[model samples]
Target: MNQQRRRQMAENYLVIWVDGNINMANEHCQNTLTQLCGVVNEVNQCTTAEKCIETLQENSEKTSFVISSGALGQHLVPEIHGMPKLDGIYIFCGNKQRHQEWAKNWSKIKGVHTSIKYICEKLAVAIKQCDQDQVTVSIIDINEGDASENLNQLEPSFMHTQIFKEILLDMDHGRQAIKDLVKFCQEKYQGNRKELKFIQEFERTYQSTLVIWWYTRQCFTNKMLNRTL
Candidate 1:
C-alpha cells in the first residue's frame, strides 16, 4: 500500500469511564456530566454522547477526543452511518468521597461546567421502566477530584477509589501510544518495532474539543452575557 493509504488505515482511540452514580443520578452526578458533555457536543456533529466518543475513535488518525455521558449516545449517535466504534466504561463508588464530617455522605455533585439535561432526562425514564429500586440520577462534577482536603480528612477510606483504574492502564501524558487500547482490543496492533522506539515522541491524553468554546466564552460570551464566561 502507498504511504498515504497506510496512514489512512491507522486507528486512534480514547479511553473514558462512565460513573455509575451518573446513571443513577445520585448526588446530582447526572447534572455535572451534562455541562461537560454539552460543550463537547456543541462542537461535535454526532447526535449522542456515545457517537461523540465513537467519532473520536473512528477519525482518530485525523482527530481524537473523549467524553463521558452515561452512555448517552447509545440511542442517539449509533443509528447514524458514520458513527465510530466506542470503547465503553463504567465507574462505581460508595457514598463516601466529597466533603468532610458534615459534608460527607451521598450528596449530589455540584458546579458542573456544562449541561446534559436533555440526555439525563431520557435516561431517568429508562431506569424507572426497569422496576428496580428507586433510582435517582444526578450530575456531579467530581472534578474537584478525590485528593481534596475535605474528602481526605472526612472520608479517608474513599481515598484512591478510582475503580476503573483497575482495568484501564493509563500512562501519564501520551504514555502507551495513542489509541493503544483500541488497537489492542480490535487486534489491529501492527507490531511496528520502530514506532516503539519513539514512544515519547508525542504526549497522549484527552484533548478537549471544547478549547474553542471555552475561549469563545472567555472572549465574546463574557462580553455579551455581562458576566464571567
Candidate 2:
C-alpha cells in the first residue's frame, strides 16, 4: 500500500453515531465531532442500532468508525464485531466504571467516555490515529515508466487545473499565504501579467482563497501551454 491508496481508504470512511434517539445527545458534541472530522463527508446519525446495522451492511467498506451510547453498545457491538470494514468502536456512558469494564471485553473498542466532550476528544484523537496508521502502510507496488508515458497521462485541461487549485485551497493554507502561493505560481510559470494584477486587486476583497487559487491555475495553465508549444 502507498500513500495514495491509504488516502483513498481514509476518504472512504463513514463516521456514524448510534443511540435510541440521537437527538437526545448533546448538540455541542455533535457539532464538535462535525467540526473535527465531518469533512470526511457527513456525520451519520442513526437513531436505532438496527438502522445502523442495516447501514453498515450496505456501506461497511466505507464504515470506519461507529460511535454508540453505553445503552446501545452492549447490543450493537456484538452484532457488528468481526465485520470487515469496522476499524474500531467508540462507546460513551454516564457511568465511567461500567463503560470501562464493558470496553475491556472488546479489543476493537478504543475508548470509554463519561461525557460528551470526552468522547468528542477521544474520537478526534482516534481518527488522527487511524489516518496515521493509513499513512504508515508500506509502499509495495510501483510502476516504472518513461517520461513521455507519464507526460501523456498528464491531461492538463481547464478542469484539471481547477481541480488542482481546489485541492491547494482545501489544504486550509492561510489567506496571506494563499495569496503568496498564487503569486509564486504566477512568477514560476510566467503567467499573464494582467491576470496577476486582477488577482492582486481582488485578493483582499474576495475573502476566499479558493477564488484566488482558481484564477492562479487559469493563468498558470495558459503560460504552461504557451511554453510547451
Candidate 3:
C-alpha cells in the first residue's frame, strides 16, 4: 500500500513484522502474516530495520506492536524503544535463549518467542489492556466548586462523552436504530470474517431485553461500542 493509504488505514492498533529474510513468495512468510492478521488486521512487513523505523515514524500516532528477528531486534529495539506509539516488541527467532538475555533489559519487550501462535496470544492480551485503559471514567469533584466552572474545566473527552450519553438517552433506540447500527458495523468490519459473523448473529437475534447481555459479551458489540465511546 502507498504511504497515504497506510496512514488512512491506521486503526486502534497495528502490527509491524520486521526481519532481514522476509519474502512474500515464501510460504512460511505468508503463513506467518496470516496468523498475525488473525490477531490484528493491519500487519505490515519490513525487510530491513530502516524501513520498519520509517513505517513506525509515519504512523507515530497509532498504537503499534513490532515482531522483529533476533538479529535485527538487538539493534532495532534500542532505536524504537522510546517511541510513544510503540506498544510492545516481540523477538521472533530460533535462538530464544540468546535473545531473551537482551530482551530482559527492555521493559516493553514482551518476550522472545520461536512461534507466532504464542506471539498472537500475547498480542491479544496487550490489545485488550490498551482498549480497557483508553475507556476510563473520570470522576470530577463538583462539590468543591461551582458546578458550571468545574464542568468547563473538565477534559474534552469527558465532555464529549457526557454529551453523547445525554443525546443517546434522549433518543428512541427502536428497530431502525438497531438496523442502522448493524449496517455501520458491517461496513466497519468488512473483511473481518469473525466479526462479520458476530454482527450477523446480533442482527438476527437482538432485542432490547438482551442489551446488557450483548454489551457484556466479548464480541464486536462491546469492542465497537468501546471504540466509539
Candidate 4:
C-alpha cells in the first residue's frame, strides 16, 4: 500500500523497529520487516533513538511496541520506558546474555532476544494481551437512578457500539454473506501473501459452529475482526 493510505488506516497498535544497523536493502532486514508486518500492519523503522522517540511522541495517542537493538536500547529504554503510549519493549541483540542482565530490571521490557522469530512469537502474545485489555465493558447501576438519564449519560462511542452489536446479532448471515465477506477480505489483503493464505483457509473451512475457534486462531480472521471493532 501507499504510505499515505497506510498512515490513514486506524490500526489499534503499531511497532517501532529501532536498530542503527538496519539496512532495508539487505535481505535480512527486508525479511525481518516482512515478519513484523505479518504480525502488525504498521511497522516504523528508525535507525536513531531520536527518530524513534519523535515517532512515539507524534503518534502518542496510539499504543506502540518497540524492538530496539541492545546497543541503542541500553540508553533508549531509560528515556521512553515510562511513556504511557509505550506498551512493551524487546531488546534485540546478537548477545542475549549481555542484554538480559539490564533488560530484566525493567517491567516494560518483555525480553532480550537474538532471533527475530523468537521476538515475533513473544510480540504476538503481547499484542493479543493488549487487544484483550482494550476490550472493556462498563457496568452502570440503573437501580440507583433514573434509567433514561443513565442511558443518556452513556458515552456516544459506547452507545454506538452497543447499537452496532445489536444490529449484527439480529442479522441472519447466509451463504452469500460469507462469500461476500471472503471476497472483501481477499480484496483488502490483495498483496499480503500470508493473510491471503489465511483468507483462503477461512473460505474453505469456515463454519458457524467454529466461529469462536476462527476468532481465536491468531490468523487473518482474528486480526481483521479485532481491527473492525
Candidate 5:
C-alpha cells in the first residue's frame, strides 16, 4: 500500500456519535446499547449495560469505537467502572446546549463525587496518551472543571454563612483522621503514587467524616505515614 493509503488506514479511531454524539461511555439508560461504531458487529445489541459489557468481553478484542446515534441522546453518562480496554474518549456537542443544573454544593452528591474522583485519580496515570503532533487523541474531559474553564466570563460568588468555629472543628477532625488512616495504610499496603493520588482525590471529593476516614487511610504510605502521620 502507498504511504498516503496507509496513513488513511491507520489504527487510530475517530468515533463520531449519532444524534449529537454527547458521550458513548455512559453505562446507564434503558436502551441497553452503550456503544456504537462504524463497524456492524462491534456494538452490543443487548438489553442492559451489564449484558452489553459481557457481550463486548466475549466478542473481538480489537480496538473499538464507541459512539452515539443521536436518538435518545439526552441521557446522563454512567460512571463506567473496570473498562480497561478503552483507549480514549471523543465527545461531539454539535450545536446542542449543555445539560446539568445541579446545585454546586458538596453536601448534595458527595458520595458519587468521591467515587468519581477516586477513579479518575487512579486512572489518570494509567491513561495511555498519544503524541499530539503525530496523531491527535480526542479527549473530551468529563469534568465540570473543564467546562467552567472554557467559559470566558467569571461567575460571581456570594458570601453567605459564617462557620469559623465549625470550619476549625472540621479541620481538627480531618487532621486527626488523616493521621490515623495514614498509619493504617503504611501498616497495610505498598507505598505508591496510586495510593497517594487516592488520598488526595478522596480529600478533595468528599467533606463529611466518613470521607475523611477513607481519605486518611489512603493518604499514608511508608515515608508518608512516618513524616505526616
Candidate 6:
C-alpha cells in the first residue's frame, strides 16, 4: 500500500438503505444504523430498485456498504455486486429460505439478517475493515499503444482510479463503467465540441470496448482534445 491507496481507503463512504417503502427502512434500518455506524453519521435512502441503482450509479465511489430490505434486496443485491468501492452488501429478509436461495448466486453478499441489530453490527465491523484496507495507486500512460491495445492496458490504471474498471466491457457492469468514463471524459472536456459529440454517440450506442477504445484513443492522440474545457 502507498499514500495514494491509503487516501482512497480513507475516502468517506456512505451506507445506503434500499427499500420499496422508504419509510419502513428509515424507521427500522436507518434509525438503528444511524446509532451503530457513527462513522457514517447519515445514511442515503432510496425507495425503489430503480432509484437504488441510480443512487449507486451516482455515488459508487463513496459507497462502502448497502442494506436492502427483502422487497428491494432481490433487485438491489445483484446491482450492488456490480458496483465499485463497495465493501459489503446485505439484505434484511423476512423469509429466510427465499433469501438463502437468492444468496447462493451472490457470494459477495455479506449476510442476510432478520434483525436490524445483527445487520448493523456486521455492517459496522465490515465498514471498519473496508476503511482500513489500503493500496498504492499507479499511473499508466495511454500514449504507449494503439487505441484498442491501450484500452486493454489501461484497465489496471482505470481500476485504481475508477474502482469498477475491472469489469469486462462485455458485461452490463463494464458498459456502465464506460458510460461513467465517458461522463468523466465529458467533464474533463466540457467545452470541446468534437469530444462532446463523440461522447454523445458513445452513450446512444449499445456496444463494447471497440467503441470505447476508439474514443479513448482519440482523446489520447488528439492534442487539441487535451485542453480543458
lDDT of 1 by residue, 1-229 (tens): 3332243222222223243224423556534443333222112223345544555655554322223332342232233224333322121223222212222221222112133453334333322232122122223334465547554454432323332222223324242534673344223213333232222221232333432343233222112112111
What is candidate 5's lDDT per residue for 1-229, written digit by digit as tens? 3332233221222222223322336553212222121121112333333433444354334333333221222231232223454343222233222321221121211112212233233222222231122222233344687766533222211111123224323455556675676555533322234444554564455455453354234233222322221
Candidate 2: lDDT of 117?
Answer: 66
Local distance difference test, per candidate? 0.31, 0.59, 0.80, 0.81, 0.31, 0.59
Which of candidates 1 and 5 is the stronger one according to TM-score? 5
What is the TM-score (0 to 1) of candidate 2? 0.52
lDDT of 2 at 199: 48
Choose 1 or 6, whichever is better by TM-score. Answer: 6
lDDT per residue, candidate 3, 1-229, as tens digits? Answer: 6542434342476679999999979999988877776665557889899999998998788788999999999999999999998999999999899889999999999999999999989988888887777676777888655988877767766876785565445455778878998988777666666677888999889876677688667567766566665
Give candidate 4 misplaced runs (Cα > 4 Å): 1-7, 155-168, 174-180, 183-191, 206-210
User: Ranking by lDDT, best first?
Assistant: 4, 3, 2, 6, 5, 1
Candidate with maximal lDDT: 4
TM-score of 6: 0.49
In model 5, the runs with Cα more than 4 Å from the true position are 1-51, 69-81, 91-95, 99-229
Clashing pairs in 6: 5-135
Please list the residue runs of candidate 6 whose C-alpha ends up more than 4 Å from where it truly belongs after superposition. 1-11, 24-39, 135-229
In candidate 5, list every pair of residues with a backbone clash.
18-68, 18-69, 18-70, 19-70, 26-78
TM-score leaderboard ranking: 4, 3, 2, 6, 5, 1
What lDDT does model 3 reach?
Answer: 0.80
Question: Following a full C-alpha superposition, what root-mean-square deviation does model 3 have from the true structure?
Answer: 3.1
Per-model TM values vs. the true structure:
0.19, 0.52, 0.81, 0.82, 0.21, 0.49
